[model samples]
Target: MSGLGFETRQVHAGAIVDAEAGARVTPIYQSAGYVFDSFDDGVERFAGRSARRAYSRNDNPTNVVAARRIADLEGGVDGVLVASGQAAIAMALSALAQAGDHILTTDRLYEGTREMIRGALRRQGLEFEALPIDADEDAWVAAVRPSTRAIYAESIANPLGEVVDLALLGRVSARTGVPLVVDNTVATPYLCRPVEHGAAVVIHSTSKWLGGHGSVIGGAIVDGGGFDWTAAAARFPHLHEPRPHGAPSFAERFGAAAYSAYLRSVVVLEHGPTVPPSSTFLLLHGIETLSLRMERHVANAVAVADALQDHPAVARVHYPGRADGQAERVARLLPDGAGSIVSIDLAGGRDAARTFLDGLRLVSQMTHIGDVRTLAIHTGSTIHGKLDDAERAGLGITEGLVRISVGIELVDDIVADLEQALDAVLAAGERTATRRSAAAQLEAVHP
Candidate 1:
């Protein structure tokens, strides 16, 4: 399978036929528990002596299929599926860090991730620091503290359209003995494999591109199988500590898959954030077409961004494919494609932004990105609206900012919808200005 190409991997990686039924499609094992052959087998399973399903909360057949496929696709030893992207991050962080421990994160992360660090994790007695994603290698090394357990960043930052230099970041990880945890949701495994770039852990929100049609919400954590967790025993006491049934030490027992095994066995089993079997099936269905779907998604996004740049009402368009200020970074890291998302700033303010949104007929006005349907969202008024003016500015989100998740639709149709919407906004502004002037003139004549 390692010798197979990506197209072959996408179609055949996760789904091997069911042992009993010989089913071609991965069967959904929706049952909560599996029957053990005997009392001895059940005891062995509980003691971690035998490898079989003890409970659905611990593992599921359908979910494992998706997990195994993702692991193979990303070149990881093992992968675990969670309820959502945030869950994946939370579980990964909890598995690695505890009270008094710290993590270094990129400043350009998703707002939800930033909020989780600043609002919740910090309150729990953990320290999280933010650094510029495009910082110099020396600057990143300088930011590391003795308490730092992991360096976290997105492979490609959402909305901002900036790509982190994974290779350089990997070097920083190697120098400081920190495992780099990358959110590979935006790029997916098709465009980039973070493990090859030196990431110890790769995380993805399968709700986005992985579940290509945006039907199911899921997340995955892939262990890169390279980091040496045993040597960092003092940094990660949880992995070194004893287990309930005197199970083997995580690093010694699981080897390269220590992080992933800990996440599923401890974090998920104890907390129970299991992805449903139906959702798992939906995700599996989407993954079969991942390579094909993403190609069109990237192509369509580039064309839409090109059209966006020419519109008069558009102040600026942020698409990595366009080769602007972040062109060097895109060229270096994402030479294949910029990705499916495009962030734009309209000339008019919030009101005009709303007008443009209302004027759209072909595209959907939804918050979620990376779907087959073209979608648009104004962050200042929707997704990032909770942030204060200063906070929004720090995030590079303006009052006029709108994020577009370009889909695999016809390029001409996407451009036409945008063009007409911008025209309608300008037309409405002219009418309002004319009315205001007429009222002022009338008042002067009456006086």
Candidate 2:
């Protein structure tokens, strides 16, 4: 599998032939528990002395196959399948940090992730700090506290499309001995592999591009298996502390696989955010065509961004592929393309945004990204609606901002639909202005 190319691996990496039926594709082992040869075998499996599937909550054959495929794609040493992207994040963070610990992240992140950190994780006694994405290495290092357990960021940020400097963060990770965990949901393994740069862990929402059609909801955590947890023992006591019955610490027992082992055995098993065999099947099928879909996705995105940039109704276009301050970083990180999501701010603000969304014909109005169909959403009214006006503004989610998950549809068709929608917005704005002028004149004459 290590010698195989990405496309080949995606199809065959974790697949196993069914001995009894001679099935070609991986069969979904939908059972909750696997039968053991005997009591001794069951004990050995439970005690970790033997390697076999025990229970579906922590390990399942179907889920393992999908997890392994993602691991291969991300160049990770090991991977874990979970119920959702949020579960992947929570499991990864819980594996390393406990109460009274801190985690540093770039301000640009998915709205759900931001909510998770500030809401649930904060309630669990973890502290999170958000810093600017373009902060220098020294600034990032300075932000690190003695209690800092991890550094987190997205490979390519959502909506705003900011690309992180993985190498700089990797250097900081090396100097500070904190593992860098990246959410590679938007960029996908097809566009970027965070581990290749310096990330110790990578997360993905398989519901997005990995599932390809938005048909399934699943998530995965890929461990690079390179971070030395023992060296950072003081910062991460859980990895260093001995097992309850005098067994070796996770760092001592699993070595490079310590964090992954802890996440799978302790966090995922106990927390019960397990990925189902059915979802894994869909994710595996989706991954088989990941490379092909991503190529078309990127091409369409470039076309859409270009069209949006010159539109009269658009105030600003937020796509990394464009020439901007982040252009160099984008080129270095996303040579193939910036990604399939393009966000634009409408010139006429909220009312025009509503009109544009209402007038769209071909593009679907939805919250999801990475679907085969083009989707659009007003971020200010939906994803970031929970935040106050000031908070939303700070995050670059303006009232007029619209995020488009550019699909693999023909470029001309997509552009045509968007152009017509923009035209509707402009016309609506003109009508509103005319009505206001007429009302003001009538009021003055009557008075």
lDDT of 1 at 417: 94
Q: Write the per-residue lDDT of candidate 2 for residues 174-244, one digit (tens) a residue.
A: 99999999999999998899998889999999899999898888899999987877888888788889886
Off by over 4 Å in 1: 321-324, 440-447
TM-score of each: 0.96, 0.98
Give me the displacement of residue 377 in model 2, in angstroms.
0.6
Largest lDDT belongs to which candidate?
2
- C-alpha local distance difference test of each model: 0.87, 0.91
Error of 2 at 305 (Å): 0.6
Q: In candidate 2, which residue ranges exceed 4 Å CA deviation? A: none
* Residue pairs clashing, model 2: none
The window of 10 residues in a row where model 2 has the poorest summed lDDT is 320-329
